[model samples]
Target: MSRRLALVIFPDFQLLDVAGPIAVFEIAERYRPGSYDLTVEAVEGGQIPSSSGVCLAARPLSQGPLHTVMVSGGDGTRDVEGLQGIVRWLRTVEVQRPTSVCSGAYLLAEAGLLDGRRATTHWSRTDDFARRYPRVKLDADRIFIRDDDVWTSAGITAGIDLALALVEDDLGAEVARMVAQALVVHQRRPGGQSQFSALIDLGGRTGRFGPLMDWARANLALPLTVEQLADQAAMSPRNFARAFVVETSTTPAKAVERLRLEAARAAVENGFDPIDRIAEAVGFGDPERMRRAFLRAFGLPPQALRRSARS
Candidate 1:
């Protein structure tokens, strides 16, 4: 029996948000032959223009026993004040599973579908999303989150990762791997992985001390004391300490430790260097220090992360 899969979109919706997941299921159908019947839908049932200015024709929202229903997100979702019709429609739809990509969670939340559910969306919208939907437990760091029948993903590309996970669940890891290979993506990224890189999350490039941060990342093996960093930024030590906290929301020492931890983790996961050598190269000084840092940051030691990466 073929499962009915509907992808719901709206005007100015993200193009990839719709295309990525559709491609996943389409490929899965090729593998399993009659596995899925796909449809693209919109509130008005016409030519819907995406945020990218590309238009996709869609059918009007209809009620039925759907196997899966997915909603996409974009700038159109930011101010959903005028979307009460679609919100009402979403509130009344019946499906075995409901999912969202990116800010699409906003629509689901607006329709009261995500109330008291664990969900995630784009990291950059964490603050606003929390304020708007207080009942939805928003875990901004996750790549995707699933609470029972409702699945929500973060940002744009994370949609593909979420779809891949669904493929794994419906088919198996082997089918998921084949789909990922066809798509030229990692087989699956753990949902718990941080949405952004450590440096980017720390505001390394956009913050006031961005240049110093860039230099610091490249010189992780050097002694990156607060005083030394202050000198590089041309500020007094005390003022620099205050400014660093204000800009990065972390102490200078903690920031340096985070940078070193990122570097050491990459080396541990991707290279054959000894633990002690990786530790020293990333300024952790010794294996024990690196192990402790990894435990604090990732709740596991360096060895565990490497083993997980291999498996």
Candidate 2:
């Protein structure tokens, strides 16, 4: 049976939020013919201009059966008044899965669908979303969150990750992997991965530490103590520690650990290195120590994470 997949959009919706998932489903349909029937719909049918000013023709929201409904998010979501019709429809629409991308989570929460459910959206919207919908348990760090049948993803390109996951759930990992290969994107970034990398956020936030972080990544096997990092930065230990915290809003030790975690997790997921070897290479020193770190940061042990990545 072909699953009927619908993407909901509105004026000024993020174009990529709609295109990315549509491309995933479209490619998956090619691999498994008769697997999916795709539709784009709006509260009112016809041309809807995206945030980029590109327009996509959409069908009017209808009472027809839908297997999955994904709502696209963008600057338009800020117009709460204009979204009432869509919100009202979502309140009553029945689907196998109800999902949103980026600020689209706002609509689901507005419709009361996310009440008492764990969800996530673009990091920039987390504070506003939390204040607006206190009942929804918002995890602002995830790439995407699947809380039972409802799914929510972080901003923009994360929508591709969410769609790949949906494909994996429906067609299995092998097909999902092939679809991703066809798209020339990574097979998948597990939903549990952070929406943004530590190095990118901290390194580029100020150029002062970019070289240090890069050096630390390259020398992960070394003990990246604050004293060493301070020396590398040409500052005394005390002053460097103080200045680094002021610049990055995190202690030097914490930043180093985050950098280590990023490297270790990548190696764990993408390579077949033994967990102990991986831990040592990433400066965690002990397998158990790495396991604890992974659990605290990613909610999974190394082996479990490796298994999920391969799957």
Candidate 3:
């Protein structure tokens, strides 16, 4: 009678949404192979196709003492036909084995499972979830949210963070740390941090000044000053700044920081570059400025982010 973890897979499944948590859980199981059971269960009883054309099969929605049942989210999950099955199954949880995951928050919202509960979904879906499920306390800016038995996350990659949190709850923080280390990831990843605190939450194509955002994301390393941006848009600094806030729900400077931080994150994730070099390359003067900015925006330092990226 091993503790079992089930992941609900469906068509248009975000492949990473399915893979990230599975990878972390499998990596954790590797430490003591054969200790726990892990299975990918299709919510609607079929070999479901993912957005990438991969087919995933599963056991029929089970009604057992499942320690953890994960709901993955993606473009395919827009409708509730497949997810009603999961919500119905969860209605039977005996002790609630600390279930959670990213993008899965949408389905929970649909089931009325998140009413009055704090939760997070992918930033892109935050507005839609808010519009659809007003009773659910939604925070698009957070990576993951935990309220008693139910847990949710912002997007696909945060699934790893959710998995790490579950491991921490089950085996203790030390084991979770070991699991994260084994997976080359950080265990204590902050749930409050947004998926891309500094990246464009929009499609980068909204507002009259949307072109500026698109340009900024592409050239984050450049000295993107108010003057430069206003010049590009052929508007005065005062006029453009005002219009920007109205259109994007954030200021231009803040948007630039998001882009810069996103760039820094990519650099940290891909290679072993010095913090100073990374800071400079990402448009900061040095590690100190980047550290403060990263801390302010992401609640983590450049080094910590680099370590997490490496992990």
Candidate 4:
């Protein structure tokens, strides 16, 4: 008999939260035939509306004799009253069966399953979730977290990563690697991590910093310093530095470094340029420095990124 998986969708659910994990599970099915039987279930029996007002047809929760159950998060289900039924149903989940929630960890909290467990949720909800469920040890910085059979992800997209991890654990690392490859995702992202690099934070780049980020992106090859960037923002170096950090959630040096690193990674993966030239173009000054940075950031040197990207 194949394993059974259920995805619980509710009103105002983040559609990607529902889609990404389902896609991974579906892809896993392709590689290992008859591995799973999947269902999209709702706390209600049918036409549970989404945040977008589109009615999503789903099987009811009672249909599950599930090997794994996923609770998807959306704006519709965040409040305590909105998630009351799902939270109650979750309390009855079979202990031996793994129960995972995507961005829906907050719903789990409402029912008190997370009372003493270490967990994660969308970073934006950290303060509120902590306040609401004081006993749940929340790791706001992680992409996803797993405590025994209960797994939770940080936000919408991270659920896909978390689901792939569960697939890896259920089957094998190799199968997970293959699924990631097929999905065009980076392989082997461990649970309890930040999916997006903090270095890629383009936060608060709303005004002049916005166009400046475009400028920086375009001139990734140039030596861009704080003074230079400040001049472009038409502010004193000190003021610009403060504003940039406040807006970008990172220093000017770190932002420039990340852009250059991204450029170097792209150049490496494309196979159109040599490592030395790519390093120099991305402002690494030399291959050795770029090699070290690449190794540190990607766990692979330039050549390895090229090889893996090509393969």
Q: List the residue pairs that clash in candidate 4.
A: 12-50, 12-51, 143-193
Q: Give Cα distance to truth, residue 107, candidate 1, Å.
A: 0.6
TM-score, cand. 1 = 0.82
lDDT per residue for candidate 1 within 11-130, as digits (tens), equals 899999999999999898889889788899988899999999999999988686888889998988977986677788888878888899999999899999899999999866777999
- Candidate 2 has an lDDT of 0.88
Better of 1 and 3 by lDDT: 1
Question: Best candidate per TM-score, number?
Answer: 1
Which lDDT values do the candidates have, in the order given? 0.84, 0.88, 0.74, 0.76
Q: In model 3, what are the clashing residue pairs, if there are any?
A: 121-154, 122-154, 184-311, 185-311, 198-258
Which candidate, 2 or 4, has the higher lDDT? Answer: 2
- Residues 87-196 of candidate 3 have per-residue lDDT tens digits of 66666654355444556777767766788999888766667778888998877667787888788987777888888887777667777788888877744567766564
Q: What is the TM-score of each candidate against the true structure?
A: 0.82, 0.81, 0.74, 0.77
Candidate RMSDs in order: 3.6, 3.9, 4.5, 3.8
lDDT per residue, candidate 4, 129-218, as tens digits? 889889999876567777877788877778888888888988888898899989988765556334334424443434447777678878
Error in Å for residue 33 of model 2: 1.4
| Top-lDDT structure, candidate number | 2
Please provide, for model 2 over 97-203, each residue's C-alpha lDDT reduced to its tens digit, 9 standing for 90 to 100: 99999999999999999999999998767778889999999987688999999999999999999999999999998999899999988557778776646534456
